[model samples]
Target: MANMDISLKEMMAIDGAIGAAVVDYNSGMSLGVLGGSKDLDLQIAGAGNTEVVKAKLRTMDSLGLKDAIEDILITLSGQYHIIRPITGRGGKGLFLYLALDRGRANLAMARHHLRAIEDKLEI
Candidate 1:
């Protein structure tokens, strides 16, 4: 199993990865962060995406969808944001946030890599 720092480092190795963070959605706090560019503030990004996760979860509850979320992808003109909620034992309240440069990132491969990272995450 990968420790938090090692997991974040592995995420940064993904092609075109701009930044990555492990966050607690319940508190909107980043537990760990890495690789942010000047334009990206990983702390703020982590908080903002916490709202995204909460909103989707709330919607699912209201709609009575019993399924859990695998990931949420937000695509923009210049970037792509992926939010993956951690589902390991004791992982229910946290998530992995990844930002990628659209021009350089391979969405399919990035998704695959994120899954691998998630699988190995110890916490």
Candidate 2:
């Protein structure tokens, strides 16, 4: 099983990865962060993404959609942001956040790598 530190590193190893963090969606706080560039603030990104997660979850509930979220992707002109909520295996309210440079990133492969990282993450 991958520990938090190892998991973040594995995420960074992904092609085009710009930054990664383990966050508590409940508190909108980053538990750990790595690799953010000068233009990005991982702490703020973590907090802001918490709202994105919460809003989607709230919308799902209101719409009576019973399925759980696998991940949320936010694609921008220059970047891709992936938010994966952690559930099961004793992971309740945590999430893995990954940012990638659009020009260098292979979206499918990045998603696949992130999923693999998520699967091995040990709380």
Candidate 3:
């Protein structure tokens, strides 16, 4: 099985990928990270995204929706930020966050590939 570092590397190999990290949402900390440029600080982003996950989960709970999140997509003029929670065995409270250059990424395929990677990941 792939480990956290291997999973992060695989994510960076995706088309248009700028950065990726495996974060523990409970603590807003990154367990592994890859490909952050000067403009992107993955540690800060991980903390921010943790709040996003918590907020969405809180909203779902308040609304009494018994659904699990697949992914949260944030589209910008130049980038697509994807936050995917790790739901595989032993992956509780963790998530995979990927940043893609909008012009180079295929959103649907990226999501599909991410799911595949997540499945093989062993925490």
Clashing pairs in 3: none
lDDT of 3 by residue, 23-113 (tens): 9999999998999899889999999999999999999999999999999999999999999998889999999999999999999999999
Candidate 2 weakest ten by summed lDDT:
86-95
Clashing residue pairs in candidate 2 (N, C-alpha, C atoms within 3 angstroms) = none
Clashes counted in candidate 3 amount to: 0
The reply for model 2, stretches above 4 Å from the true place, is none
The lDDT values for all models are 0.96, 0.94, 0.95
Compared with the true structure, what per-residue lDDT tens digits does model 1 show for residues 1-123? 999999999999999999999999999999999989789999999999999999999999999999999999999999999999999977889999999999999999999999999999998
Query: Each candidate: RMSD to true structure?
Result: 0.6, 0.7, 0.6
RMSD of 3: 0.6
Model 1: runs farther than 4 Å from truth? Answer: none
lDDT of 2 by residue, 41-119 (tens): 9999999999999999999999999999999999999999999998759678889999999999999999999989999
**What is candidate 3's CA lDDT for residue 7?**
90
